[model samples]
Target: MSIPKTMKALVAYSATEYKYEPDYPTPQCGPDDIIIKTEGCGVCAGDLKCQHGAAMFWGDETQPSWVEPPFIPGHEFVGIIAEIGENVTGYKIGERVAADQIVPCGECRFCKDGHYWMCQPHQIFGFFSGLNGGMAEYVRLPKKAVIHKVPLEMPLNDGLLIEPYACSKHCVDRAKIEVEDIVVISGAGTLGLGMVTYAKLRSPKKLIVLDMMDERLEKAKEFGADLVWNPSKVNVTEEIMKLTDGYGCDVYIEATGHPSSVVQGMQMIRKLGRFVEFSVFGEPTTLDWSIIGDRKELDVLGSHLSPYCYPFVIENIANKTLKTNGIVSKSFAIEDWESAFDAATGKYRDFKVAIKF
Candidate 1:
């Protein structure tokens, strides 16, 4: 395989500015690094939110910006190894692979403590200029990066979905679901559906999904959700309470970026129930804090980026234990990124959207 001197890439210059550069310099593999020839990369909800200057990415009066511009914006990617450094072991050229979204600085306290996902610098691919993402013809993996070999037989869309599924796995793990507990997962988007699949593996007494879109709700059922609800057509709080014999659900996982879903999870979870908050909200959510401590005494947990979950996601995706069909509903060439972005942002009724390189 021949590596290109220049490649097509989506470059983010600012919060609202992104350009598709047809001649961006292809990353070079250092003695301790490897280069991947990108096959496909998924468009994440955070990408869409960052594009519109969401406070979380752009920062606000109370918080600092998490994103550094002049970088490529995609983290869910899969590719073939085009070049391998002399020092890199256990990987060879032409192998299919995917890497964790975050590249931790090994010297950080968090990294030293085995919590590299929360490294102080927190440089996630696609958001840091030094760590370009896979929205290009090739991507470079630093020696410290966590990389996993993807099965060549895995479908392209399933390969691209590895990152999101890893995230969903972590979120579900945070819930600590029991076999006899009733589980309620909010939102039926890509992440939520992935949660449904993994949560079902626990064989909860009942797994319920909530979403405004009937299309998404239908897919939830196909992914092993026992019951699906459209919040628009039904009172989800009352329905969940009724299903739980007025006790409320034992576990509630919030995957919807909407504020209402946060409120709904709080209102429908029983006392001492575990609540896992996983979504990257576009705006601040105002809720009654008293409900968490005074009324329910719920166990509130936060789920962040995928940590030590890539290998599991890759193996399960290859084995078909994790369902991937109908999740990646649309794809576009890198040249048509604007249309892809629109489709990913709900302009079309899509479960997930990807940019093919």
Candidate 2:
């Protein structure tokens, strides 16, 4: 297969500034790098949030900007290894592969301590200029990249979900659900549904999912959610309390970027319950801190990008243990990225949307 010198890509110049380039430079593999010919890349909520100038990505009064523009915008991607550097080993051309979203600096304190996902510089693909992402014809995986071989039998769309599913698995791991525990997962989008699948495997007493969309709620049931609720239709907190005999759920995982889900989780979780937050919010969420420390004494944990879970996710997805049906609701050719982004941003209320390269 011949590699093109240039390819189409969606480039980000700044917050709210993006353009599609038909002849962007194609990535070239370095001495210890691998170049992937993109198969598909999922559109993440974070990407949409960043496009709209989310404070988390564009920087606010409290924190510096995380995204350095003039880069492509995609992290959930899978592809074929089109090129491998001379020094690269254990990989062959034409094999399917996926890399972790974050490219850790390795020398940072967090990376040295084995928490590479929290590398101090925090350069995530698709966001940092130096680390271009898969929203292009080819993506370069540097030497430090944590790479995994995706099984050849997995569908491209399913492979595209590996990144988000890995993050969801990490969130479920943080919940530390017990067999008798009643777990509640907020939001029925891609990450939320993935949580439902993994949480079910934990054999929780009851796994509940909350979302406003009826279609998503229905899909959550198929993904092994014991109960699906629409906060708009019923009193979710009251209902949860009734189900738990006024004690509230044992674990709450928040996957909705909306602030209301955070408040709802706090109100419906048991006093010492595990609360795992794993969403990228477009705006600041205001909440009382007393409930966490003084009142409930909850164990609040924040889940970042997937850490050391990609292989598990890949294996499960390939074996059919992790249900991925209907999660990838739509796919668009790279030329039609605007429509894809629109569908992902709720124009079609899609569960997940992808850009097929």
Candidate with the greatest lDDT versus the true structure: 1
lDDT of 2: 0.91
Q: Could you tally the backbone clashes for each prediction?
A: 0, 0
* Per-prediction TM-score to the true structure, in the order listed: 0.97, 0.97
Q: Which 10 consecutive residues of model 1 have the lowest summed lDDT?
A: 49-58
Tell me the TM-score of model 1.
0.97
TM-score of 2: 0.97
* Total clashing pairs in model 1: 0
Candidate 1 lDDT, 239-311, residue by residue in tens? 9888888999999999988899999899999999999999887668999999999999999999999999999
Given candidate 1, what's the lDDT at residue 343? 97
Q: In model 1, which residue pairs have backbone atoms overlapping below 3 Å?
A: none
